[model samples]
Target: MPDTQLTVTLSGEGVGDARVVVRALEQAFGAPDELPSDEKATVHMATFTGEARAEGSPTAPGHLSAPVAVTVQGAPGAVRRASETLARAFTTRDEGAASGDQEQERQLLLEP
Candidate 1:
């Protein structure tokens, strides 16, 4: 299988809001390499491996105190899957995307 590792970065009102986003992703992609944390910074990040599972509880709109800025990066398919999964779970605005020879990145603004 092509590398399906995906990295998700999020910045929200606080760690709690970010966790909500992560939890939604966990449903579709299983657990991440590590959970998101403040790390004394404004953003948190987590990495998920393998293809997104087909069977899982359907993602629903998660509550957020404020909009969350999310960035997904990895193999093109992996990035696309992650982005779509998030959109299904939240009101999202596509910020844009960029592609490299071996990886892709997309940004989204997730609303409450």
Candidate 2:
């Protein structure tokens, strides 16, 4: 099977909040290609390349200070897995989603 790749774009909060979300994603998708940098911008992005964890030790979800808007784009299964991972880590409000022949995208609002 092709490697599942997930691209996550985050905004609304700062790097600290972004890290929290990234950490949650790491639990399922493993480490991202790179860590979230301190770019002093409103948005941060990371890409994870691997399969989602179906069996592993569960960890406590991290806390968020303010709401974070997350946009995930990837293969259909990868998008769904990442969205589910974020939802499990924080309270998420479904914004909307789109689908193509081979890829899917979803937007979610995560709150403390």
Candidate 3:
């Protein structure tokens, strides 16, 4: 299996909101080591980025956040489910999402 990325975002009041978001994700999808370790399934994690969005409201209330992007190389269905759940768990709205190889495959420049 190849490496992948995952992003989880939380949007709400103050800087502490992000931490709540992270906790929600960990609960929903499991921790970094908990994802799965297999020749066919390798889950690698990247730290999420949070920034205040003065742009008013989405589904919750005032302010918003950048979506956390996650990537990985392995099972497609599992990855997609994990991604969706992560978003749904964090906020009252679906603020988080996971984009796998499909999103990754398009960008060559991101390669190391």
Go through the candidates in order and give the clash count of each. 0, 0, 10
Query: Once model 1 is optimally superposed onto the true structure by TM-score, how far is the C-alpha of residue 100 displaced, in angstroms?
Result: 0.7
Cα RMSD to the true fold for all candidates: 2.0, 1.5, 13.4
Residue 80's lDDT within candidate 1 is: 84
**Among all candidates shown, the one with the greatest TM-score:** 2
Flag clash pairs in model 3: 4-71, 4-72, 5-70, 5-71, 5-72, 6-70, 6-71, 7-68, 7-69, 7-70
**Top candidate by lDDT:** 2
For model 3, the stretches where C-alpha displacement exceeds 4 angstroms are 1-4, 9-11, 32-79, 86-91, 94-101, 104-112
The TM-score measured for candidate 3 stands at 0.33
Prediction 1 global C-alpha lDDT: 0.84
- The number of clashing residue pairs in model 3 is 10
| lDDT of candidate 1 over 1-112, digit per residue (tens) | 5356888999978888888888888876778888877546689998888567775667563689899999999988888878878888888899999999999999999998
Evaluate all candidate structures by whole-model CA lDDT and list the values in order: 0.84, 0.87, 0.33
* Number of colliding residue pairs in model 2: 0
TM-score of each: 0.88, 0.91, 0.33
**Which order, best to worst by lDDT?**
2, 1, 3
How far in Å is the alpha carbon of 106 misplaced in model 1? 0.1
